[model samples]
Target chain A: MAAAPAPPLPDFEPAGLLRVRQGFDLAAVDPRSTPGFDGGKDEGERLLAAEDEELSDLQERLFAQSRSGARDAVLLVLQAMDTAGKGGIVRHVIGSVEPQGVHHKAFKAPTAEERSHGFLWRIEKELPGPGMIGVFDRSHYEDVLVQRVRGLTPPAEIEQRYGLINEFEAKIAAGGTRILKVMLHISKQEQKERLQERLDRADKHWKYNPGDVNDRAYWDDYQHAYQIALERTSTDAAPWFVVPADRKWYARIAVQQLLIGVLADIDPQWPVADFDVEREKLRLAAS
Target chain B: MAAAPAPPLPDFEPAGLLRVRQGFDLAAVDPRSTPGFDGGKDEGERLLAAEDEELSDLQERLFAQSRSGARDAVLLVLQAMDTAGKGGIVRHVIGSVEPQGVHHKAFKAPTAEERSHGFLWRIEKELPGPGMIGVFDRSHYEDVLVQRVRGLTPPAEIEQRYGLINEFEAKIAAGGTRILKVMLHISKQEQKERLQERLDRADKHWKYNPGDVNDRAYWDDYQHAYQIALERTSTDAAPWFVVPADRKWYARIAVQQLLIGVLADIDPQWPVADFDVEREKLRLAAS
Candidate 1:
């Protein structure tokens, strides 16, 4: 019997294809579109498996460089609605690397103490240290996204947050942080099916939030909020990628490719030994 | 030709075989021995690969239970000599689960502020919240281990820490935390070979600490310190497991199995729905 041929790799890069540019229209993007990737589910998974090792190696080099006082770091900010696969990206993509080198935070609604300070106060505390890959499940953008959609903040106050976010990101970028902001874009229909699955499965009940269903009533409002947030805050220092996330596998692979691109660009090298190697070897032998 | 037959699984559980008992002799245990496991390198690696999925699932369930107000959590505390594979246990074993659910802390020398407070004060702040798996690369045990060996603290003060640790762990255990302490035991000859390999490889240079060779001068003192600490602190609430670490693959697999046993005993079930499932289904259909 003859062997089967190998599958072709995705030719285009997700970084260029998925990045939100000036006048980018969220309504125009089909949630089901795979963008740069042409593969089906099985092939997408296979490609991810192939890329995982390189991702692991690159992250280790970044971590190693940090120990020698290198300030370079990568911050991956993931913003999504319910059932949009933010948890999946964390588990499958960031989870591929050494957990010690990855700093992950999943932000929730503010507490009384957090609300007393500026919107970015809590976020500034959790930024990744040198050579670490920082992940934010949802971030400071909620000031404009949910707060704006629900009219929880004044119109003027919500409007000012965009420029403030840009300034904050520029400061972080100046400190040698490479920021990749991603918004997992899933359609209303897709979310309905996903939410329904949660309701149906006995094992998935804890994940089913009744508030998520109530949020569905304001679907168009949230989408408008997202479009405006994407337009005003996406800058050269921190660009947002609107990933079509209806196909769970496609979303994961695209985010992984984006992260791999960021690390490769940093091109971190292992730190050279500062001490004398021969002396250390002789010293060890004596011990 | 037919496919190769599957290898047989190891018969004994690592949890029982590796736990440190009363009057435990550190000198009698062989660093090269693979107790409760008859497998060689290839089989050990294969077994870890096979067990990885179950470990991940068990972790997810534990995380899920926490969402429903469950107080249960697991803490894995790792103590080891230099080049004894503490990093390997982290990357290969705990890294297999969701990074979000794993709260990992690698303690360095205490800062000036940390030094001013009691030693346990800093450790208390970093304990994992409900439904999380906390990993300490080097933990409270270091206060006794390194501090005792170097006489950094008064011998009278060092004597008090062991009782403090036991009381602290028992209080934590009463609050539904399962503590698994592991000491990665390696031979001094094996340490020399590992340290030499690090010095030879340019890529491994960053991991080579010159201070490690200095520490080896105090090897016998350190081992004696470990013996006393292990004997005093290994209680039923948080028993210490002394894992043979000369074989890296065996060490990784044994830790994984021990973690699996802990999670399985907890037997976290998927939480039942608090809201009406039928009404939610209908509401989703309307949306």
Candidate 2:
């Protein structure tokens, strides 16, 4: 029998290809595009499932490394508009790791105390400790996006936040925290469908907010704010990836691939035994 | 041929059967017993897998109810000796739900600040918020366990904590948190074998603490301490369940079943739409 040819592999890397560079244009990107993934929904789902063991192993190694006093960690900062699948990414992608390894925060409208402090102050407090995967459902980027679009802050102040955020990210990156910032890009039509579905279903009614539609009135301004934020803060210390969110499967797989890439780069080893193995074996045996 | 008879169900409820009642004897309980589960490792694993969707649904309902202002929540408190598979329960059973809905805390030896406060002070701060399933890998019960075993606290103070814990638990339970405290009962032989395995595997060494074998010297004292803690603090407001954890699969399923039962009792309903669905539909369409 003739030898079977090896199956083709995905030629491009998601982390590098989907990454935002200087002069990145939000308007030029397609919300439904599945960049670098040549798979349909079924194939995408299968590939994601297949990546589970590697993802799990990598996560556990990172966690184990932390126990041995390695100070490396990962922070996944997810920013998106309402109904843009941030929660889906949390559940499907980040959910694959040990819950113990994840520190999740969903930043909401600033509380009185939060508003009293500098924007970066609250953001600094929630950074992941060594060996953790910290997730921010909506993050400090909101200061630049919603604060700019809604006139919540002065134009100068909002403009200043971009530099502040870059400095803050650089500090953390230098401190051994690998930052992955993702913008889940969904089209306006997709948002309408999602919001409509939420309104239609009694079970999903709790997730719908009247303010979300009100915010939709300023969607263009928010997009402009995002464009500015992306252009200013996509730095070498922490770059952003714009994952098209119209296809949930593609978005999830893309995020998973990004995480896998970052973890592989960290390449945490299982810490070598700090105690004498032979003596400990005898001690444990006697115990 | 006659139709086959329906497969028999496990006659007892693990939650009810394993509950630590007054006068419960810790020494008499077999660590290897399967309790209410009538299955071997493979069947137990399969059954646990089968319960995932139901567990996921129940958890989502609890989370949805929270968003709609329901105060209900669950706090799963796990207490065990070394290598008792507490982490396994977290990874297998509790890990089935959306990560956003779970708040996990693994209590370590008290820091200087923690020691300065009352033992229950730190515990109170980490309780699950509305709609969350909070997990404490080791809990306030430790104040009674290791503290008692090692004489870390005065006998009078240790004796006093049981009452304080009951009062604290009653307060929370009254405030809409369902508490499920589980003690993973593993035999000394099992612990020895598990410790030996950890010592043998380089990848597992990070998890092995030298203090673990030292703690093993007082294994009997720890059991006695657990017995006292169970007898005094396992009240109607917050009961304890002694799970035979020699079989990791059984321990996970028991905890999973306990969670399912508690959530079923809470019986969180999907909140009714607060706004006019038709009106919102039109608004969303216009947006």
Candidate 3:
């Protein structure tokens, strides 16, 4: 009999395709393709459901380890255009785990006090403690993205932030935080559809912002800013993952998988009992 | 034929049974009773499941309103003895909603810097922004509860904190935050059972702090402190609710109901579109 045909290889590994490697070009990555995930939408949903239990378990262990004096954590930084499904990723992926272990900060327009200090001042206060899973929805990158695109900051200062961000992330990584930066890449066409959907539904009206249209006018500038940000800040300590976000399901699953991969690498274990277990058991039983 | 007798009213409406009223006595509340809720453990679980959709919807509306320039927000202050299920409330009740709208702060022992400032200074910084639900898993009340119980602060100063807390809460309440202060009341027997459970399970050993046992020795003192805190600070602006927390399911549902009630009261409305919808539709279609 002829030898059986070789088993087919799985589609793409999202970690590799999404990661910002040297000379990575943002324009080259298609926002609609599910690069590493071969499965269709149904498959992605199924995979996300399957990973829920593991994610919960890993998060609990990480929290337990932190309570036992471990200084390791995971920080997920999410940057995306309006209606690019940042909220969906937060709700579907991070929402699966215990809330006790997750720290989420949605950075909005800076306050007067925040503007007076260095951009990272407020951010440093929100870093996850040991054993935490921190999610930053539009983080320090905003200083470079919007400020650069809109000409709100001096060019020299904007350039300085890229270096500052890299050094800051490197210092935190050295302190045991596994940083995963994700940019949800949605096509302009997809964005128009989403924006239209927000307008079409009365219930979604509150989420619609007239300013978003103004921002859309500067789309090219924003994209160029993102390209420079990705090139400058995707260091070894904190790598950026350009997630193809046109399909909400694929983006959610890919982000979940990325988090799971980092957590598995950390492999937090439950701490051993500090007191004598047998003695405590006997004492408790007697009591 | 005689008409069937009407069903009896449920004794404990968690919203009413748990809310602090004038001359409230913490000692009178039974930690094990499911007040106003005629549900057993299974019923509590089912009710919680039933409320999940509404809770999520309310939170989303609150978040949407906040984003659309509504200043209204809800702040849930969780104060409990060790293992009283503060974490469980966060996970089961608040966790069901979109994480983007929930701000959770787990206040640990104060650092040297925090000690240098007034207690509320640190707390003021963490207050939920407009349109967010902030959960304090142990809050400024700690300054009174632990500090008073342990005599960490002078008696006169501890006495002064209640007035300061009320003033601070009033200031914020006037600014649009609706505060719900919940005190999880568990029986001494229940605490012992919980503490013993931690000691028995190796996986839970990390949560077993020997200091918790030491704290147990001061249970009566802590109760006395809580009684005073509840009596003094349970104002109309920011009332305290003492939920019988021995039943984890009941406490979680009750807290959820409390939050739902507040959001319902606020009645956040969807903002009208600032831009001309018809024009945007034509513009997007043409684009």
Candidate 4:
């Protein structure tokens, strides 16, 4: 069969078409036009369901292929605005692999010990072996995203660190790792509704941190920071796919597709054994 | 709905049943003799399905509840014989939670760095925090399983190590963390079939090792060791369940049940936020 055409991508506001497959139009996925899809609302759910099934099958193949030992390990770094479902995407995507073959590292606040060493010190040790996949829920990118938005580092230093991240990733690639970075971009109003949902339910109350709302107030700064990070860092080695986060399910499906693509390239196969010696012994016994 | 009684386990070899569920009767399960399932299999499968759905739901609920600052983390430890699907069970069971809320650490052969510390040193740091579910691919039990089967450690010292592990895990539980251990068991013929399948496929060539075969030679020794491990380690604080490995789907379902039972006991409800400031602001806006 001939190769199929790529999906069309959504229109970019400024630096859009992040994943830019042929037919997928992320640009047209405006929240106001179809806010909170329901059975009655029926906002193209049928279209997505058909496409998601195809992607899931492709993902299973990638999952199967990535087990080969010769291939480079796949590393996915997920960064999202608050309430953008970063954790949700991480769970759904990497959850299928053999856990031995899939390693997950969540980068939290820089530890006193971690701060004493180079930023990559703690991260490098956690890289997945050739037969495995490693995922960082919040990764080394935080050094750029959070540090930049909070002005933890000076402008000169921030500009310098971007180059540092690029070089660090280059070293990772040179050592046989494929990296896919995703940034979940949720809109302001969607954030409001999600936060409200948490507050409305007693079981979800703990998720609504007041500071998160304060952080949401600085949504514009965070977006600009994302823009710079994406512009400066998106490269052939590790391209950034800024997934639309308002529709959480779509974002998850998109991330899974990207991961399936990366893992398919890794070639996950089981190793064969040298059975000649045992075979000879068994033959001798039979005779 | 009324809670169902514990599900009836499948007919197992006396040894397998004894090692697994503690009290399975071979006579009761012999398909050649027994005319009917007695609703045991159906009930077990139903409970398994229920448990899977419940655990999947709980994973999301826990992820959101994590911000409540309650360290109600569930630590799942999979200990079993080779080809038992310890890794496979994990891949399918926790497949839904986002990677951020779930941390997977697979303890491999001790690196020079890991061996330098006390045996459990590398494992201790990787334990899950409150709100995060840490899935250990092969955990501290390796000190007991691999090292024993291979005669890597002296028999004299193995006894002390067992006590030490119990004490170590006990302390972890006492500190408010919950632990559930699943031991995956499969028949010898089934294991050989799985191995052969791996060898026949070029893609799976990376998984079969001469060493795994070497270890397979001592399948009886390993089985005895596992029986001991299950008998000794299945405590109230951290119980070990021997799961059937001939069917991977069943094992995943069983594991999800164990997790829901353990995590639910922690009563993983979200902590209500003291949202006085936001409520006052919203009221002012309304006024």
Chain B TM-score of candidate number 2: 0.96
C-alpha TM-score for every candidate = 0.98, 0.96, 0.87, 0.77
User: Can you list the residue pairs that collide in candidate 1?
Assistant: none
Number of the top DockQ candidate = 1
Candidate 2: deviation at residue A253, Å? 0.4
- Cα lDDT tens digits, model 2, A1-287, are 45555355454368877889987999988999999888688778877777888888999999999888999999999999888888888887777788888889999888999999999888899999999999999999999999888899999898788988999999999999999999999898899888888987888898899889998899899889889999999988899999989999899999999999999999999998888989888888777
Instruction: Find the candidate with the highest TM-score and give its number.
Output: 1
Residue pairs in clash, model 2? none
DockQ of each candidate, alpha-carbon based: 0.73, 0.52, 0.30, 0.36
lDDT of 3: 0.89
Model 4 chain A scores worst on lDDT over the 10 consecutive residues at: A34-43
What docking tier does model 1 reach?
Answer: medium
Predicted structure 2: lDDT: 0.90
Give the alpha carbon lDDT tens digit for every residue of B1-287 in model 1: 45577768776588888899997999998999999998789889989989999999999899999988999999999999989999999989998898889999999888999999999988998898889999999998889989999999999999999999999999999999999999999999999999999999999999999899989889999999999998999999999999999999999999999999999999998988999999999989998
Candidate 4 per-residue lDDT over residues B1-287, each given as its tens digit = 45555655553222223233454332233212212123344554664555556776676667666665666788988876567787666656776455566777777899998888989899899999877898898888888888888888899877788788889889989987888777666776677776666655655554555455566678778877776676667777777766665766656655666677676677676556678746834632332
Root-mean-square deviation of each candidate, in angstroms? 1.3, 3.3, 6.1, 7.2
In terms of TM-score, which candidate is stronger, 2 or 3?
Answer: 2
Residue runs of model 1 more than 4 Å from their true location after superposition: A1-5
Better candidate by DockQ, 2 or 4: 2
